[model samples]
Target: MKLYHSVDTRSLRCVWLLEELGVSYDLDVVPFPPRVKAPEFLAVNPLGTLPYLVDGDTKMSESVAILEYLLNRYDGGELRLTPDEADYGSWLNWMHFGEASLANIQATILRYTLFLPKPQRLPVVGEDLSVFLQERLKVLDAGLQGKTYLCGERFTAADISVGYALLLSSLFGYQKYFTPAITVYFDRLQSRAAYQAARAKS
Candidate 1:
């Protein structure tokens, strides 16, 4: 197995899961915005996106989908909640919520605030998205009011999926608005050995 990743990108989700599963895989760290910085990578994945995975004949791009693929293909039973489990629906919902909801807004804020040139940067747009992101985060904060993890006590890939979004919130300077519950939850996630190991590799 091999993964193409870039520092602080969504690929961290996959790397963290690989560490948690204790799987052997090669990490190929490429420059960020590989589409422009690493033109050669376009041949490997036309999309030139980060978090690209190659496992034998299988290849994946979406970060959350990669997590599911890794869990299903690698017998990651310890960190997976099956369909028969009571919290299965919640688990799947939170996993996709991280990227589809939180990261989507965060990425737009990033684009308006930093990625775009100074003349193109729009503080008003970034501010509006930041407010929108906080609204989304409030839902997560409420859900985490009494749980150690997203699916109650079990530390599954759901945590890893959402955890990366929390990490991104902090990296993008929106953590100052993090609610108390979110702060505590993110602290717990950061303290995990697997998360720490993945950070080191990133």
Candidate 2:
């Protein structure tokens, strides 16, 4: 598999997953600013997003989907996904919430703060985002109250995905605004081996 990636982006999720899975493959790092719009890239994903993967001719986009695909298909090989099964109903639930709800909240903040030009950006956007993120983070904190990983006591690719999401909040300077338990959760995710590897590459 070949991964097309950019630093400090959603690509970190795949990088962490790759490290956790101990997969050997190729990586094409595209630096930021003008970003990657190579014709070859568009051929893999018409949307032209980073974290695009090409496993032989099987091209895939979207970080969450790719992580799940790699884990399920490759058995997460070594740092394998726990409670491994053909049926991943419970695992998918946590992943869906993190991808759909948590990512949406963070992406919104990114757009308003990072993507939008300062002159046109709304300064008050943080207040609105805080309401949703604070509530949502508490839910995640409650879910992890007695657990080490998202699905249970063991780490899985879901943690790689959601853990990267939490790291994103920290990178964006949003982690500190959350509750204490949430802050500690973000810290642990930051300190993981796979996460550190992804950060170095990113």
Candidate 3:
């Protein structure tokens, strides 16, 4: 297996999963945000996105899908809640929520507030996204009120997915709005050995 990664990107989740699985793979670190300009990286993934994975003849991108494939193919389903599990539905909901809902707002906030040039940056738009993200985070906060992880007692890939968004939000200075419950949750996620290992590799 080979993972094309860049520091502090969504690739963090994939690398963390790989470490958790104890799978040996080559980590190909590249410059951030402009993988398209690198000819070698472009050959591996035409779209030139980070977290590109290759296993023999199969190739995958998108951190969430890659994680799903890895857990199913190699983890004996240990990293997921089976359909019969009590938190299965909640797990699926939160997994997609992390990316589809929360991540969209995070990217918008990054673009408007930090990544865009000064003249192009718009704090007003960024504030709107921040508000939207805070509202969405409330749903997660309520779900995590008395739980150890996103679903229930066990830690699964769902936590990794949502946790990354929370981490990114903190980096964007949105942690002040993080509910006390979620603040504790994010800290717990960061304290994991796998998270620390993956971050060190990045």
Candidate 4:
């Protein structure tokens, strides 16, 4: 199996999964272009995004899908989070919340920082997004209350999927609403040796 990776991007999630899974895979690092428009890259995915994966016959385009694929295929090599995990119901809920809430946070950040020109950038929406992210974090903070990992005691693939987005917020220079538990959780996620390795490569 092989994973195509990129540094300072969501591909770190895939690399983090690969490291956690302890699977031997080669990485092909592709530099992000200033303007992401290329026929060859677009052929891989219409969105032309990073963190793409290929395992012999399988091709995965999203980080969450890739994380789940790694978990099911490798028997939870490191982080055993499966949608059908022993804690399936809750895991599934976190996964859905992660996708929906994080998507809004990411899209809003991009529109202000990169997607829009100086004159076109809307600070109002960015401020609105800041409020939205805070509101969403409260729910996450509550879900994480009295828990070590998202799914109780053991670390799982869900952590990698969601944790990667938190890392994104940090990389993007946001440091406003990190609570004590969230801080602890992020520290735990970062403390994993696999996460360290992934961070080095990323």
Q: Pick the candidate with the highest TM-score.
A: 1
Best by lDDT: 1
**lDDT by residue (tens digit), candidate 1, 16-97:** 9999999999999999899889999999999999899999999999999999999999998968888998888988999899
Residue-level error in angstroms, candidate 1, position 98: 0.9
* 1-202: candidate 4 lDDT, tens digit per residue: 7666678676787798888777899887766741253446666666777767878889887777787788788787546644444677778667656656865487676789667879988888788788888888788788899999898777877777778777867776654577788888988999999999998984
True lDDT of residue 77, candidate 3: 60
Using alpha carbons, what is the TM-score of model 3?
Answer: 0.92
Note the Cα lDDT for every prediction shown.
0.92, 0.74, 0.84, 0.75
lDDT (10s digit) by residue, model 2, range 1-202: 8998888778888888888778897988876532344556666567777778889878887888888788877787533445556436666767767777687788887788778888877757866886888788888888788776775667766677677667777778877756776676667777888788888984
Please report how far candidate 2 places residue 146 from its true position, in Å. Answer: 1.3
Give stretches of model 2 more than 4 Å off: 33-44, 77-88
Task: Provide the TM-score for each candidate, comma-separated.
Answer: 0.96, 0.85, 0.92, 0.87
Off by over 4 Å in 4: 34-40, 81-86
Candidate number that wins on TM-score, 3 or 4: 3
Candidate 4 residue 44 C-alpha distance from true site, Å: 3.6
Report the C-alpha displacement of residue 73, candidate 4, in angstroms.
1.6
Candidate rank order under lDDT = 1, 3, 4, 2
User: For residues 63-98, could you state the per-residue lDDT of candidate 3 as single tens digits?
Assistant: 888888888878726678778877779888887888
Number of backbone collisions per candidate, in order? 0, 0, 0, 1
Give the poorly placed runs of model 3, Cα more than 4 Å off. Answer: 36-39
Clashes of 3: 0
